[model samples]
Target: MNNIHLLDLIQGASGALDYVNSTVTGHHRRVGAGAAAIGGAMGLEGRDAADLVTAALLHDIGAFSLDLRLDGLDFEADHGDHARAGFRLLSVHPMLSRVAPLVLHHHTPWHRLPPLSDPGPGQADTPAAALLANIINLADRVDVLDQVGTRRVVRERIRQIISHNAGTVFAREAAEAFLDLSAGSEFWDKLSGDWTHVREAVDLPMADDLISHDQLLPFSRFFALIIDFRSRHTATHSLGVAETSARLAALAGMPPESQDRLRLAGNLHDIGKLAVPVTLLDKPGPLTQEEFEAVRLHAAASESILRSVPGLDDIADWASQHHERPDGSGYPHGLKRDALSLGSRIVGVCDVFTAITEDRPYRPGMTPDQSARVLRDMVGQGSLDADLVALLLDNHAEVAEARREAQARAHVEFERYRSLRVDGAAHAA
Candidate 1:
């Protein structure tokens, strides 16, 4: 695999979060821009400022459910739930360690926040991380205010809100920096433009260098969590698919590196589902034609999102083509068997297997015999690759055991995620 651009990958993953609702479309970008501008005014530059923008882009990532995301639009809402969730999700990943603490405390009020030195052993230096979190808090509120009303009206309202919240809801220094930037037309002008302008306005570096595929795994898992955790119906779907795909690739004698790539592809395959409504995903009955069409778009949407980052062309194709069929009966591109790569076929097969065997809100999982029959029917109809289907069915017990173990581990994580409200409560008290 080629080295992937870190910023592009970060931005691409961020885009998935912003895709969940129209109210949040470009919301992350706006906050990133605002935080970068404010961070600059407060004398933050280089890695500190860049990490601020990264945290801003992913601040709402913990709001996995549509309900949690929608609730965020309420300026007075308790954001502790998602804040803790985001922190836990990000803190476990090495690449996002610096950004994690900021995300955890982004909604914590300046007065209520613990001392700067509290983020002990192995944590990011808290003085900077704490300030950066508050900067993000201020920037987040500014964007939320900007979301409604005319530009002039919104700007005035934002001015009043910041002024009212300063020194309490916001750190005094961060609030002052925001006010200073808002005092001039240039800051808002740069904000009104693209993210590129916002990055340029703050002198944030955009690293163009690529990193190894191994370096991208944490992010892949992160994206998987974001994609799957949106609904209980899919809490472990991506992980299951990822495990099944990698296992299938190994059974097919694919190279270890290639197996890893397929694993990543599986993790990201449903990223486009972020654009899909939870109502549709969790519906108990069959989808109407319109709803089906909306759900079907996720494949193409996944391709579009993954393709935006460089060095992910193969990943994009493998992920997007999971819905494609040998008989050219699948969606998005509807390519025939000849057009599909082995990697794509593996993902497609794994997706089918996982979907059939996983319990859903509407139905229980099929037994192995039942699942085998279904797979045979699919292969007979040219819906799945005959060879891959046979390989899975032939090794059904091993595959099923592997998928079950993977999802069991995922279930532990999901339980921990769901239980974060307790953590939030303890912290609040």
Candidate 2:
């Protein structure tokens, strides 16, 4: 329950997740580790910086899929779901309540998203989380472009990725900073461009990262609680969504294994928002351009976080692709409908449904009718599939009932918390 305990839990959880995703996916891990190092070097306190490193390491914690065959994953889709899964699992744990939101919304963009800033000194740490998210973001690009601890080719290739993003994927500030970091020596090369020298440069976390599936899953579940702690409104949002979405997906005829992955993806769908400022998250007014820009980064943040794991690429792929629309309106990647899979598409709808139906600090949960109207509009706009919307509408009663059941569990938790409060008071006597 103390910060030290929480930190230990986080370290174990993150290290395990990092091992699985990195080993299985063959994407870089040290970039996240290195990014955390930069934050530590930049004067973040030991715990905070280490937490950042763990976050950096396991941010993509949702990307691994238990059922996914490893050969199908390239560097692209496998590790994407880690963020959402990671956030939801952490949200339920004690002491880690604060990190929950950052883990959830680290990919959150500024402006008109969940965790909109609220007016007050009592508002939580969304902004600080956002700052760390930004640091991780730039660090991710820097690591990829520098190829972190790898060869020069990978770094050069990273520049090509940045160039490709041009006006999208990254904002000018993010791009500019990344470009500056990309400059200088061979940091832009493959992860081992300086293999002989680099092996001796600094101790890497790889060995510690090696982990079994059983060890990794619980660790991931732990961080899910941390992500939910980011915002009062979103505390249980990811978990509920994942649970209900998986149930719905199965009811809608998805296979058991597919449903499992969907559940994982749904659990951490909003993992990136953890990095946004709480002020912005709870803000009641319209956001300035800067704030809005911050909101857009959440999905990308989610994607980067997931990439650090070992074998969870399938999970990451589906989860990270949720924000991406069929019409190429999504952030992180302007992936159009063709690029997205059936699982990813289902997640997109589930995320929208849960986000709107759930209470937000800024607005009331939309009525089913209201949520339906908006989703219908989205379908017409080519952002969503009209047929899928219709299917969801048909299943509205089931979805609502499921959500209510989940909410009831929270009421029980609330009562338990109240009981603890009373007990603690009596004990003080």
Candidate 3:
């Protein structure tokens, strides 16, 4: 496996979350950058800073998972439910577990914060975690501060708000760091302007410290949950495709390394769909032409999101090209048979097969024989690769069984997350 930067992966995931809602687009990036600046002002410049940035970038992930509407809401609006949900989501992964508690208490006011010696239940309760959460809380509010007039006026008003809330809504040290940093115009300029490249401004962990493929597979599974759990229609789509595609790739005699890439591609193939709203995804009827066109853009979006990471170019290509046809007629790109790789072809075939085989709100799932006939028809139309279609037909039982097993696991995960959301809401109420 190639070496990949952990910061790059976090940056890519931040971009993916932006697509969840247009109103909150770029929200995470701004918070991450601002939080890093605060960390630096407080004399944190190494792994501690990097971890703070990572927490900020993924702070809003639980909101995406819950399909919450954040548009037009105040910066300090009630978000405890989503914050708790985010804590639960990130606590499960080894790489993200340390940062999980920071996300949980990001919305907690400074006055409400528990003492380090007596931190409340489920809280990490360390001084470092508390400081990190406070930094993130202040940074998040800074990004969402209402701007109604000139830039200078808005900046001054935001500074006043932070200063006024010091020792109450904001931690004294964290608030002081932010105020000292914001006293100059450069900080405000960077915060309000193009800040997508802010990750480059800070010192992140070295590429050598990056996790290996084995470690990455679990993170990818966690990502699949974030992508698929938003809607019942897509609750198990990524897992089904991943399982079926890997099985088909093995049947085609591909090497194990190549098969692994195919499976990763399968898990991320529809990651761009995160940009599409749950309303559109779960619509029970046919999409209008405009909606269909909007849907087509997801393929290109997926490619753009994955391209940001340093390595895994092969996985990005295969995942993005799943929509391209063998003929020159497919969407996003009109690449013909010569341009598409075998891995891409395999993913394309499995994607279609999985969609037809899975039950949808609009229609029931088709039987294996029924889905096979549809795949064969597509092959006849020059849309799908005939050889890959043959692989599916010859091993229909095994392929179908793999898809079923994977989806079963995904369904259980989705239910668990659903229960968490409900419980969080009830507790908040």
Worst 10 residues of 1 by lDDT: 420-429
Of 1 and 2, which scores higher on TM-score?
1
> Which portions of model 1 show Cα errors greater than 4 Å?
149-152, 194-201, 205-210, 420-429
- Clashing pairs for model 3 are none
Comparing 1 and 2 by lDDT, which wins? Answer: 1
lDDT of 1 by residue, 1-429 (tens): 677777778778777777786565777777888898888788887778778888988888877676665464567777887787787787667778667778877888887776544444555676787789889989888877777434434686788889899989898898888888898898787767654534355567655446678888778887887788887788899989999999999999999998999989999999999889999988878899999999999998998889878789999999999999999999898899999999999999999999999987777889999999999999999999999999988899988987888888888877775664322334432
Local distance difference test, each candidate: 0.82, 0.55, 0.80
lDDT of 2 by residue, 1-429 (tens): 011133233443453344333433223244444454445445555445544555564555544333222221232332223444445444444434445444554444322124323222332254455555555555555454443233444555666776566444444444555566456653334333421222222233332334443343444444444455445667667766676667677767988877876776776666666555556766778899999888777777667656434345666777777788888998778998888887788888877787788776667889988988999999989888666678888888888777667655644553443243211111111
lDDT of 1 at 46: 70
Query: How far out, in Å, is residue 363 in model 3?
Result: 3.6
Measured on C-alpha atoms, candidate 1 has an lDDT of 0.82
Model 3 global lDDT (CA atoms, 0 to 1): 0.80
lDDT of 2: 0.55
What local lDDT does model 1 show for residue 94?
Answer: 74
| RMSD, candidate 1, Å | 2.6
**Candidate 2 Cα outliers beyond 4 Å, as residue runs:** 1-221, 410-429
Error of 2 at 188 (Å): 23
Better of 2 and 3 by TM-score: 3
